[model samples]
Target chain A: MEQARISARQLLMLAILFEHGSAMVIPLGIDAKQDVWLAILCGMVLGGGLFFIYYRLFTYYPSLPLTAYSQQIVGPFFGKIIALVYILYFLYIAARVLRDFGELLLTFAYPETPLFVLNAVMMLTVMYAAYKGIEVLARTGELFFFSLYFTAFSGIALVVAAGLIDIHRLQPVLEEGWKRVFRIVFTQTLYVPFGETVVFTMLLPYIQKHEKAKMVGWLAILLSGLNLAFIMAINIAVLGADTVARSTFPLLNTIREIRVANFLERLDVLFMIALVVGGFFKISLFFYAGVIGAADLFRMPQHQRLVYPLGISVLLLSIAIASNFSEHIKEGLNIVTLYMHIPLQVGIPLLLLLFAIIRHRSSFLFRKQEKK
Target chain B: MAREGIKEIFDAIERNPQFRTTASVVIARKQTAEQLLSVLTPIDKIPANQMIKTLEMTETVWGENLNVHAGEIIEDFSLAGKEIVMSSFRLDRNLKKGQQQENVQFVRPPARLRASELAMFKNGKLVRWISGEEARGVLWILNKIKQTAITVDWEGKEESVSYKVMRAKTEIAAKMKKGKPVLTIHVETEGDVGEVLVPIDFTNPANITNLETKLRKEIKKEIQKAIQQAQREKSDIFGLGEVVHRSYPEKWKKMKQTWNEQYFPNISVHVTVDTFIRRTGLRSNPYFP
Candidate 1:
């Protein structure tokens, strides 16, 4: 039972930044090769459809968060278990994105810095933001969104002015054909950054205006999706599809190649800024969702006490997530995307929606039969 | 410019916006970095940025010289593991353009821009320089040819026909033939008759067709010469290796190790040039009968 309310605009900004997050820094959908942009567009379509399921569930229990509403849908015992699993899922993803940004900064800028140090600093900052409550986090997102796009657009302008883009690099479209593109769309792109918006279900009840929530959510998804696709296309066009696929961070490499008049080269800083801002918001939102959900399920009067413990766990979990950066990436792409993301983001929400529907229909039918 | 760590130079340029940057770097090999920088320092009396503008306006328009920035080198050689081929120039303070002043008390050495040479680099080391028709031939195969005036003999030694290339596109395809990679370079270009010293009537459609046939042969010869020079040097500057890598990733992984030394030097390449004389410029049939 949180009293703070955020406007629809803040919700939109948070979701957009959440979707952008580390997804922008790391190469997403690169398995599709030159048609990676096409795969992102396909993921957006699937993600948009998935949003409606969460939206309908929100409609069923508008006054309560997902953790509380699951109890009403099923019985108390099962709903508490589902809520606990979701809380753990949010914390897990928060840790994963935390590790992603930490690894990027370590590789690119801070080679000597320990991974734990980077993750700890980021986790501490996120803890502060989450402790401030959802309203402050949303407002912070509203402020950073403008600066994020400013760097993004200016970075793109420099790349174009440098004359690095080669349209032919994207040529022979679907060179390997549609099968690979769709496979990428379903496995990695769809569940990842896009379907990961399922974390927002815990925060939906905090919006000031419920009527505008659906539109804002969809708009944010569409805009962030297009932004990702456009950036990937530019990366492939500038660096070529093969180099892009091979790159650990394609966007970072793409920005590095932007040298307009020789004065504007070495612009990986802009990429770092964008990634940090994006990663901050992403980790904060998931951290907030997990904190509030845990509080709701545990019947705590205030969620503030739980933030520090959970934040420390996230920091530790990020470091303990994998042995090395490659293993971390591999586990995220191959193992986690299949095992954790699909089931929690897509499967459970969908089944919860189905059960909610059945409960509604059966109750209505019983009432009708009693009247007869 | 090539002596300094390309990253360090770029970082310095980025830190100070007032110093600004030019389109091309003066690459030197024989001289020390201090000598090259000092030689370029005084030449700033005329300002090289303005000179770059002049080159872009008069030279790049006519497609004689091109501007290759440091970023292209970083991307190609550092990121893509590809060779670098760009327009090369020698500082000739003696070579001046337009009219010369008469009996001047103090005459500053004029830095004229003339690009007849191409510098090729392999793994950050200067390999060799190719000039004359061979350089233009490389540009042709790379499809970097813009509006270049190609002069062809007409009627006799006194008369000539110069075709201006307005647009050009190069398509390179690698196909595995009998388990060996073969390359097909197709150059498609169209241009107008820029200057004609001959007395032929260009208004007639048949005459334009006849001129295109002759121009095609000249272009083919230039491209073949360039390709021959590249193969001889064992340099894959045209990024044919990249094309092969894109077409066949698994195969390239094996070929990449010995690409420049083994595969590129021995591979067979087929060149095709398609040319068209679209317009006859401002005047048709010339001023003569």
Candidate 2:
């Protein structure tokens, strides 16, 4: 039995690394076109509102992870099933992000390398991070946060210097009216990177200051929001929206365009380093959540023992999840966004929040009426 | 299950570790790049790097001495907009495109190899190559003129006057004329007399005005030649389509599909050149022996 704790800043870093984890690698909502920056802005503002709702739910059941409190909120049988689903979601998402990382490596870096090798390597590292516990993961995240920004900003600067960034490429802002921009904001961009932060609910209980977790959450959201907007803008400015939409790895393309004074060319390696570091944090946090949530639900003694089995399961699932990269991308955009992401990320948590308020505010009255 | 689809391979090559992401691309005349590089001299240096440098110099400083880089080529071909016109060039015994000076005495043997051509792309494929003044015309229309020369001949005079451009600015406006975009390009050039072989009054404002009109006309002719060549090749290397896209994004989406194929050739172009001669070199006329 262990109680792992992290500072509010570390929590923010974890949230940012997780939410921006996948978005940083792939093109974030390519359908948003030149207006993706707007989509990111809208996603953050709205996702921030939703995060407030999640925080409200967490505060009502202080210091208890979702697995522990779902039982108190709902009955035993329903709670176990809900907890199981949350555990599965944690494992599934960890696997999904793992797959995205693997595919990125395969598609961008190593074409000849086996996909399983890439997935397995990431899974093993995540397992190690999870075994070491949340503190190590948080520290690694902090280290990576600076590196990620440094790489991204330097890439942008080089791209600008190369005169590859044409502000004209980001033209015709909101050309389809506010309605079109808002649509993708909710449907596509909202789910993946923004709403995806819902998984962090499991980590919130470990915050040193539980009350300030909301503030940390907002800070994390705003930070990632601006980052997403800035990157998408650069992607459009350099690669243009059409190229970005077609390319599997738009950031890689954008970074590759960075030829500063000639010799600084092909800095996509820097991007690869940052994404790998970010993905490691994201997967580790998700892995930690899944192992802990499962142990808590089953009343298992040691969470560490669950790490290996769970990580191997994830590696296998990640390999079997989709046939290839395109299918994986399609599943993410289509199945994950509409089905798993919406209901779990936004819908279920929302329902839980509503249920918690009713149960707390009116429970005594209901019990009194029953006794009479 | 693994399928190495075309898309996947393309991405791998794009993000490959070995290839330089910022390497300059060369688009040749339906020929291997080696044949083009074969003639590019300075045998000790890499041909690709030299070609890239040559193309870069073509953007701002070079006139007949210029070359268009790979990045500029992509800008003209990118499908985000339709009215895109990029640089066009070629190579031979004579230095074509933006060749500036004629009489440079060689101190030593120059590089035997040279790559000087701007290959215009339409929809990501090479469409045509426009050389000499036409290629320079592309730069003028794009406002990429830093320093160039124009020789305006007086109708009755034997020797001509040459103006050296110090500053050049072009403003291209894309507006709707009927149902399509009508591009109006305005070019302002500031220069000074570099060579005056014919006798002319340096103090007289009338003569300066006279030379300025002749300079404007010459520059206009070059631009017109470029636009006409683009229309002939149906290449919008000028990025005129981008102007339309920025101004009217909603309409552009529908138009972007056919922009390079059908619309680019049909779009109307209006070009105006403004030349202001800042000063005359030292003496008004070439130093008479």
Candidate 3:
């Protein structure tokens, strides 16, 4: 059913943008204090290992998506149940990311506009992208990749030119010790921007170069990881660790400090652009993954038909998820990362891989004995 | 209230067809808002509403006084964990031609730029004004000192031997001693000789070293004075509290309540200054020397 194929480069772009999406704005691993950058690096390393598991699982099937292959690994009934759970997980995460963008826009730009309107508008765009098929989304990622990098680099340049960064704030590094960094890495950072790539498993079968998938995934992780680390470091250096932790959107505040001349002040526009672009790609990818997964499980011909229903559901779910932004963030960091992300992203995938290996070994040994 | 006051000022200015143009304005808290408005008033129309010509130019101009924006104040306030924030602003008077000609042989401009003074805020309220070397000392500690001239005594008198700070870096460390925080501030500054009022010889390297020691002592004195004032005001303006919190988080939990009141006031501080004289200006020594 998945006929469209995306180039390896497109996959790389999509992955980078996905990882940088809402994670960039929200202070991921802020509990690490000034060593938040360090924590991100450590998380990226661990995330690399997690991706290896997903890659191995993908190799066993080769042509089938995670939804299709699970049935082959286990019985069809349980595999169908697993696929349904993953579909729900994908849609729920998509809603959560949508809410992230909506809340950011509400607080940063429009305090008066109802969050429903903001999220609905964002969801509409994501739905359109989802309906367009994965090829279109990948092409869009390739197009936006350069502009995103341009915005990031220019932001770094302007901040440096303004002499706002005082590296002294990042000093006394590892002051409290390694425990907090490691704790935050495992609990928050590793799962968030890194392990969220589990959604890509649904899309990996669409890649044209299956042989290069592992390399592309790892490179994308490294690039986005370093980008996030550097950006967070700059935020702490410019705004100070205390401010970064306290502020809702530290990057917006960091960009606001770019006053080269009197005329060149208030450059939060760069932040807004980067955020919207990143949010668009990220939300679209997750939304697409859910729609496609649902279509596959229900034995539907066109996944495009499910887009509108799922899109509306995601929009409403985003509003209903939490009473307020703080609650949303709290639930996300504490509950979702622990309960949802770990089990679906890591636990179930590893379980499937183990089952696939054991089943293959038993069948091979039985065939050999029969032949003898 | 501050926002309303600013809006009202701009509204009044906008309504006045007499003064149609105003570029930038930096209003310091040296005078009451009424007094400031009063000075701007008593407007005499020069020739049909170009009121720009009439009033005493109480408006602050660039190069005369540094303009501190609201964003910067908020950033610093948050960075220091709401303890204390400092900004520099000063009032400048545009001198009329007669006063400028009377001051010196050479024709001077029709304006005078006053030295920038540091304004300290505690809990978002303006607490005190710090001027002179003490203000510069705060700048040094904050690593905001870009170009400042420092005067050292030459030949047993406070004669002009000013070292212009080219660049500076301040490193603050908070160490736990006997379960209490002891602070150490290390300042490394490099500069050129700006002015030497007395005859000073740069021919011998010993003289340079001697000058360096004097400069170091002078910087140390300024930093101490600033710290003393901050402690007297019960404000940890140097972000020393943050340093302690960063280094020893568990200990800071108990110390947070009385940080400014008890710990900061009685906190033992050690200041170290390292001064390097890179160049002596146009000549090796002063032409007079």
Candidate 4:
């Protein structure tokens, strides 16, 4: 295997997507109300713990991807089964991300452009970078990271500076009560983005030095968490709790309200550009990881060739899986939030950690007995 | 290692091919603009003098043409203008004996009046009437003489005698004293009589008490009427509604359910009145000077 190097910064970029994964749905805060930020904060704290678990796993098995390590730890057959399950999970996530990006573009930008064209264009870009290898992906992430942060922060500042925001809207704090807040934090926040950091396992092998990997991962998780919390707070302050809860894309709509001197209005174009670029990076990274995992499972000589086929498959899968945007959003919120998001994101990783710990303890006991 | 390299080459071939298409479109548009500009310049050139002259003429004519068009468009429409006058009139008219008359008083008689006076005096013994203390005494003596002569004449005639008399009375009281009755009489033969009353009881203690009581009652009624008018106008200057709304939001919400019926009726009201008499009407002294 070629040595593929990635900086701590690249890891931070990857962590941002996971940490802010729920951002796309933050606009739905209008439905969630005052509890939205609480949900986000809770997600961050819980997601940080999950990120730590992931970091521990990667630190324990430094050189191997999850696919090979699981097989070594558990028997080959069980390991293969688990690897297959992970492969499917990654591919599904890739497809969902593609669909999410496509839906956002279609809803906000070009209504007439076919989704296949958009997905294909994005997949091509991802495939090109993936072929160049993980080093290319990390470098690309590095190049875009600052611009991403600049666009995001400037957008928020513009919205805040518009002076239309009413601080009284956050009054009667915890109007929905703590129970709903806790439910949202646990059910809506922790499981989705925080747990999704499990994908970091694949990238850990490419890290240049393993010494500070855990610290880097923790810092990335924390920074991403704080960023999301700030975003949610701004959305609430700008749009009000009720409006934010009802909105499907709270941050985007908040940015949409940014107008400078009346002549420079409707800067949703800036947001759309940033979103499409950021979403491309996120989806492509997942797609590449899925292809590599699939190739690893089959013992294929090369994983790069699978990129196009998998991209096409995912593009079609995303289109066919949901009937329309409403259905997709509903499923994402109601069904996926409960089942796929909670169990896969949180449950599987916890189970894997438990298994790893039990195995470590038993091996320690067996080694002591042999020494005796 | 060779096989991995071969696989890598194959993977590269499998990547998306759309970037080339977009790049080509951008390149082509740039290339075509240069080609078009290069091809069109030399073939359609006119002399510079003619071109300059034509351009100048067009610029000069365009302004006039636009103005003419504007005038023609305006001519087809109707325009309207109006002048408004406002005036306020003051009327001063005196009613005397149910007849309208213009009476002029001269400070000094003109030459025509002197001539008319001399004509009147030339007929016989002259008689004149003037107004002052001396004239009032003379008028009294003449009135008595006329009355006596009329009586003698009537007595001598000895047919019949008819007398018409009228009387009026008012209750008068001093500021510190009790009430008193005052009477007035008028006697006339087919003539009109008029009299103005000068009330002398204003300073009486009884009259003062009555006036004070009446004035206080009238002030109270006036205050009530003003309050009723204010309520009818729905002015909440007293901030009663604000008090109720703030103190009881839920109750206010319920009250607002039928605000028109419940909130306006029997509304809490308070009023304070202060009165000062600066001057009395006409009679400052008990008797005429």
Candidate 5:
């Protein structure tokens, strides 16, 4: 057994934590307006199908990671090229998540705090976790899972108790019909909080219950999808579609409106703590993925050796990611969704699956002839 | 103040976590806000928090609640929705009377309790005050009426009867009439006879029916007054525009730009009330009867 392997349950928690870290704060499937819940449902169904494809690919190459298997599936020349592309993709995603955390801190928690300093500190801690390997990361994620749910659920529970969530705001259900909701599900929303599950393709190979990894991956996507939909629905119900659309952080704004009584106010602090912890897990997982991919692609013996250098590079890349917050938001909402996400998260993965099936069949045929 | 001068204050407030926790926003007219801060005492046991509690209790029991929190104000005052109505309080002019009631003056300061007025805002600035019956009507239309009282004149008699409302429900339908915006307000409420001095058979369904008609008329009067006042101020504080947007999205897209000034004032408003007197209090018939 690999020294740093995780069980199916740990894998599920890590994926949920990673997807939830950013999705909970930023509004998901919002273009569908009050019917964003429907958008999320449609998107999740499609997201599950996409995850299954990735899982199928994983099953074909049970012992090998994406970096090693790409070369085997494709010719050595193009396969190494594809592997290098994935390595860069992981690194870039790590930096993007780092930027998200740093920008969030700069915007809400610390106005005086420099982005570089926040990124540097976060990257160092994330690098340490990544260097400790996936086993420690998985354990840490499993441990923090309870705390995350406690604070997040309690914050939302208070809001619901405060009578701030008006179901009337969600009235005239499917007023615009399912067509518009599905359109939004397809174009803008699916790949974001859902298709971002593609990162798990790398991590899935490390599950100790290798046969059940595929089942666990699909289950993780299913659970996280429902959770994302529920969270977004609560936000829309509390903040209203118009307000939720305008807000930069809908969950933060919703939590701020939670007034249970006189003294039990300002509970956004508790939610903020939960989100920061979640953000840590998200960034570290992506950072871990990047470190592992780099080590494998470069034919290195150990992933621990690549952590600090990758961490420093990620810090620098995150600082240089966007000029300001609005631009970052614009790119995140528009550019990333339309361009990078569709291809890297969805398109290339499907292509990988197709190629994997073809190669496996050809190799099996070659062995059959030799046996004869 | 220069923007930078305010920036320093913002920075300081943000830096100090305690400031954020204890902060209570008081929504009033600029002059009224000034007067409140002036009379607010240093020894007033956390005046900011006290004011918030006071505001909530008044809204809780009175049903004169209008959310004028800063965020709500910004939201309702936007182009999407163009009005803000908040419960308002003033330093009682007759503080001496309040002092007479209480042995210790400081224990209960002379802020008015029966505050049935709402500070009205357009585009985040106070435009006017909707007072008394009109304010209650605003709450009535918004379905916030709780433990409120409404009176009806009984059969041309000088004596009137008041019903103490136990529950109230309201709904506003925003539909177009002849290619223009129109609103219909429906109010359903049940209450007990609080005080009825007229000499009549209180148990008689015939008399009760007459009373119900008068009650509906009185409730309608309040709703009409609120509608008229909203028109006069050219603000859609009732949020009928939002109703329109939800039910009639395409129409709203065109009306939203002029909904506040042009369409709101001119829109036709129809009020309907269903009042059920569930209880006749301790006595079936009045002493006079």
Candidate 6:
């Protein structure tokens, strides 16, 4: 085993993606109308619980990766199978993330480019980071995190100064009852980047200090959640909720409207770059986790060999998965939201924790008997 | 599974041979000029030409009867201008000149002459004649016949007063209509005052009364009060200036559409103060000066 040290701030970058990705989808899914900010608030509250669950899992197995700890907690055979299923689940999610990035790029920038080209380029970048190991990924995240933060806040400030923002746009908040808000919250938390933080379990073992891991994890979640919520609020305030819902990329659309002195139009290009970089970190982390989990379950000599094949597979699968953007969005809302996310994000983790606790209690009893 | 579903849709679209990438054209034309004419030939159909009609034109040109193939395309046609040449039959010598001059000045009609001057012939010699203000009222009638020979025709009572006429150190007076002396006048003088009485014609008395009534109604205090109230409310919905402004845009552009901005300003308004002496207090004799 090699020493893999990731700082609290690097972990915070991963957490930002988790929160922002889901937060980004809220404006995409629900017809926010006049209450987009409210929709975002509801999403954060629901996403907070999901984040806490990941935090709980990180606390329980402080030093063990989820794949190894899962086997120890359950019987090896069943645990390995469970771990393999999780790996496959993660691979599917990683592929979908890659597809989202490719689709956004193709739609916004180069309409003539093939989907595979976009997918392949992104997959290669993620693969390079994944092959470098978690330390490099974490350090790279740490380096880029400040730039990402600056870009996000500066983008918001520029939009505001452009006179494009209307505070009145956020009015008539919570016009739809709590029920509608809850539905939006549930969809966002369940399927999107929020619940996807469960994949962070794979990275928990790499934290430099084990005790501060839980604190850092929770802090990352909180900060990222607030940042995402603010971004959502700004997007809605600037574009208005109705327009946000209609738009494919809410942030891009809002940024494109930023025209300071008539010369600073089309800021979406810069926005797209930020999105791709952030999305790269997000996708690469999941891809690495998927490969490592699969290798552990198969008792392979090295996980690096699985990376290229898995990368190509994801690229191909993403192209084959959705015919168009609308279908992709529909699958995200319907199948991914209802079936895949609930069990993986909420159910499986809780089950594994229960199993871990019972095993611990039984081992204590067995040791006491042996002493007698 | 999802990929297969999407593939099926694309396959179905490709397999449909009749599915066109663009819009199609339709045409309607006669198979032959007359069904009885069995000598007509049918041409092969092209995609561009779904239908075609044929006709015959007989004309005598250059001393020979020529039977020409002629027909309308009945839809759209693309022709090459280089393949055909056309010439006009009119001769250049028949064209008129000076009709298309680039510039020309317009002449105006003559102005009307003033009254009180008369042309006279004494012993068939030209001389000055007397015509005073008594005849001034009928000057327009007299001037119209001055250009042509005419005899005077009178059918009304007329009266006149004695007056002196002065023109270039000449004074002339004559006994006119009421057996009073009339003065010929070109220039004005204090002693040259003349008076004439002509029979009054009162045509359309009903219309005159109607007009008077309408004027009186418009001049009422209640109408003025309503207008004042509307002005205070800043409701120029009546569009008084809008009407004039619309009729004369160039003149009104300097004023600007400032009714909402400045409200109404500099508009001079006058209210007529009519005091009826005969109808004071509804009794003519009770009026006190």
Model 2 chain A lowest lDDT segment of ten: A322-331
What candidate 1 gets wrong by more than 4 Å, as runs, is A368-372, B1-289
The Cα local distance difference test for each model comes to 0.79, 0.74, 0.77, 0.51, 0.74, 0.52
lDDT winner = 1
For residues B137-172, write the lDDT of model 3, one tens digit per residue: 776776666556778888887747988666677899
When 2 and 6 are scored with lDDT, the better candidate is 2
Could you give the CAPRI-style class of model 2?
incorrect
Candidate 2: tens digits of C-alpha lDDT, residues A229-269 = 88889889887777776566778878877787868887878
Query: Between prediction 1 and prediction 3, which has the larger lDDT?
Result: 1
Each candidate: RMSD to true structure? 19.4, 21.8, 19.0, 41.0, 20.1, 37.3
Per-residue lDDT over A1-372 for candidate 6, one digit per residue giving the tens place of the 0 to 100 score: 125677776777766654554245334434545554565555555656766666666676777677877787787887787788789888998898888887677655764466688889889998888878888887787777777777787887788789876787777777776777667667663346556778888887777777776676667666765666677777778877655655566777778788888787777766775777677877887888998887777777677788889988888888877644555666777788778888888888888888877877788899999999
What TM-score describes the B chain of model 6? 0.19
Sort order, lDDT high to low:
1, 3, 2, 5, 6, 4
> Candidate 3 lDDT, tens digit per residue, A105-182?
866586436678999899999999999999999999998999999999999999999999999999889988999899
Pairs that collide in candidate 3 are none
Cα deviation in Å at residue B280, candidate 3? 54
| Tens digit per residue, CA lDDT, model 4, A59-93 | 66788777777786676998888788887777787
TM-score of chain A of each: 0.98, 0.95, 0.98, 0.93, 0.95, 0.93
TM-score, prediction 4: 0.54
lDDT of 1 by residue, B232-256 (tens): 8887888888888999999989888
Candidate 2 per-residue lDDT, tens place, B1-289, comes to 0111111223444556785445454444333445545443442245556666666665556664344333443334344663333332234443331122221233322323343555565545555666678777887887777787777786676437877787788999989978888988899977667777766755445678788888888888999888888778776777778899899898898898788678888888888887876445323333342
Instruction: After the best TM-score superposition of candidate 3, give how far the Cα of residue A102 lies from its true spot, in angstroms.
Output: 0.5
DockQ of each: 0.01, 0.01, 0.01, 0.00, 0.01, 0.00
Interface RMSD of 6: 43.0
